[model samples]
Target: MRVKMRSKHRKAVKFYSTCFGFREPYKVLIDGTFVHHLITQRLLPADEALRDLLSASRVLGS
Candidate 1:
């Protein structure tokens, strides 16, 4: 699934990915911290980190 981020939460995404042992570099810096892809085609769970991110970046009527 493709996820569109509302805001580029760079540090948070990187930190979370790192914590989860995501793909190498674990930190892709683009669009001011908007992670285009995560975990090399792996499915990300609906965890708190993602929830917080979504809540923070949630767009209206989305």
Candidate 2:
């Protein structure tokens, strides 16, 4: 429900949530708190790969 981040780390944190694999139906928690519910059609390797891709893009700026 709430996302807490320091002022200097705001933009980067937002990108990690929205742009990365943490956005509606896969829920990721922070310190036992809910953040978002990112979803996928299936729970196969492909879907896992998608998450990995998103993470890579954030680091590589793809």
Candidate 3:
């Protein structure tokens, strides 16, 4: 299941990059709701989590 999800994420990133010119070191918007959910789910080190989810070289939050 995890592997499948990761593959899907990679595919999505590739598609976005190819068709939309989205570059690496992606910028992410972190809102209160997202922060709350992360805390509730105990997903610490938010930056790393976002980086992995986006297959980004680095994650820049706004």
lDDT of 1 by residue, 1-62 (tens): 12445345555567666797754322323342334343443424423345555443432221
Best TM-score goes to which candidate?
A: 3
Given candidate 2, what's the lDDT at residue 35? 20
Off by over 4 Å in 1: 1-8, 24-62
Q: For candidate 2, lDDT tens digit of each residue in 9-44?
A: 455546777777654333322331212223243434
Comparison by lDDT, 2 against 3, better one? 3
Per-candidate clashes come to 0, 5, 0
lDDT for each of the candidates?
0.43, 0.39, 0.86
TM-scores for every predicted model: 0.23, 0.23, 0.81
Kindly report which residue stretches of model 2 are placed more than 4 angstroms away from their true locations once superposed.
1-5, 23-62
Question: What value does the lDDT take at residue 37 in candidate 1?
Answer: 42
> In candidate 3, residue 57 scores what lDDT?
79
Q: How close is candidate 1 to the true structure, as a TM-score?
A: 0.23
Flag clash pairs in model 3: none
Q: Write the per-residue lDDT of candidate 3 for residues 1-62, one digit (tens) a residue.
A: 28999999999999999999999778778889999988998888899878888877798766
